[model samples]
Target: MSELCHQAGDARGMEDLMVDYYVDRPFFDELVGLFHERTLAETRAALEGGVEWIFANCYYNSLSAGWSPAIFREVFVPHLRAQVELVHRYGARLDYYDDGKLDASMELIADCGVDVLETCTPPPVGDLDLRRAKARIGAQTTLKGYVDLLWVVKHGTPELVERTVAEAMEIAKPGGGFIIGSSDCFREGTPPENMHSYFQACLNYGVYD
Candidate 1:
């Protein structure tokens, strides 16, 4: 990744590769501000590099602790909008990833022209009503995911998992846009039996026919 960054003659080439490194480091206020600045700078560089799609990740767990809508609008939204616009200017699409409650951020996300919004978490934290999200975002944006990962798989029985998957398919799969998967990253402690049950459910219930 460092080699790629060097080859491209800019930091943008290695932006994705830096994710792990950033994860390991501590987050300070100065660093947080720097993070946003670097994101905008790298996004512009990526657009200039002939990239076709830009994956934009919004706030993670921090939103749950009350990163209010006003704070996002005043501080973060403009930078995100700029990134989306820069990508669009280069004929690319933006996919914004936010697993937190997006009720506050939806308008800003839409305003940024996000082509795809991944509702990667389930209800309470995210829009469990995939249909409503689609309606709200309208036809211009594609809605993806709303599966209850922790509830259906980790705690539920195999039969329950199967039933949940069947229900999810009935609601989320009728249309052409949705994709079914874990609501968040599959955790290590998730039982193997539950994992097996989840995949079996997907296989048994995910078919169009």
Candidate 2:
């Protein structure tokens, strides 16, 4: 994907080309803001009808938008803030999903007023360490993440799953602002036993008394 981006950027060399266009703060901000105004109308109305949560499948759009925290803030945050405010106005919550290197941007994202942040992956898969991110964003933002789905779940031992979930809970399940989850989607080939261990560990170790 990165190589394709480079090739397209080099060939087109246009201002609105995918590379520069995605990173262009002003252009995307206005574009997304205006776009959401029309699109969120029905969705916001649905929330008014007694929805509990509004899931902004942002990672859902990350494929086309090509994510970066910088782009997220400049282009997406303003609109995300608006959406969150809208949801809250209707007494609903907004769950923001973005699977990326979020260590630098989680704080900025927290400022956008999302109730929950999805897919907060820890390194060496992503740069986020929930222990640290909890301090930064978890004071207000509820952290929801499935930890290291591929390496730590799909290919891991039951003991590894237990140990890993325990470590994550110890760091994040404090002051009541954490939700255990896979940092990314559980792929098709994942072991069922490991998946069971994950949910079981969350129930066992994710308690806050």
Candidate 3:
């Protein structure tokens, strides 16, 4: 990878780097295998230290990385499946984090036996359809995060926060597989009143009965 970048010259753009290092590269499989091995080692160490959940942050979201369904199924899925198996063997849950355009890959991740899928970013900022996701993979995987932190949480009114939370609850809360949270961590300047409303709405609608 470094060699490719060096050959491409310092002024080469991100597109050049992406093509050289990721897309159709001869060393892709070898690099992926090495990363998988390192991740497994880290997961094992964390589990041995009594971690209850393994957070696997996959940087290969298809929207930006241009990964095809074939590449995802053939190359990535097996690595994810192995991680799930290893985590389960140690009695720990695996939380797969890919905070972008999950609609393309959500089912495949769930099918890998992952316990939780994080940051189900909704439309505009991302393309995840929470309703579709809930109906499809909710039974098998816990769906964490759908709230839009920037638009609805930070900038919108408290009423909007409640409404967003309520809407999410209506779709994903029924089957006991949803977790209401922001697209990412709540930003620094988010209004306190909205934060209160977000939690209050969760309490109001999150009740099972």
State TM-scores per candidate.
0.70, 0.81, 0.85
In model 3, residue pairs whose N, Cα or C atoms come closer than 3 Å (at least 3 residues apart or on different chains), thus clashing, are none
Candidate 2 off by > 4 Å: 1-17, 20-31, 60-66
lDDT of 2 by residue, 69-156 (tens): 5655665567677778888888898887767667777787789888998789777776787778888877888999858998899998
**Number of clashing pairs per prediction, in order:** 0, 4, 0
Per-residue lDDT tens digits for candidate 3, residues 1-209, read 11112222233443553565456575555555665676778788989999998877774534435667676777678878998999999999988887777888889989999998889998788789999999899999999989899999999999999999899999998859888888888999999999999889989987776
Question: Candidate 1 lDDT, tens digit per residue, 36-141?
Answer: 6667677778878888888775544124435567755664566677767777888999877777676656766777788877754657556446555556664557
Could you give the candidate ranking by TM-score, starting with the highest? 3, 2, 1
Error of 3 at 175 (Å): 2.2
For model 1 the local lDDT of residue 154 reads 74
Model 3: worst 10 consecutive residues (lDDT sum): 1-10
Candidate 3 runs further than 4 Å off: 1-17, 21-24
Clashes of 3: 0
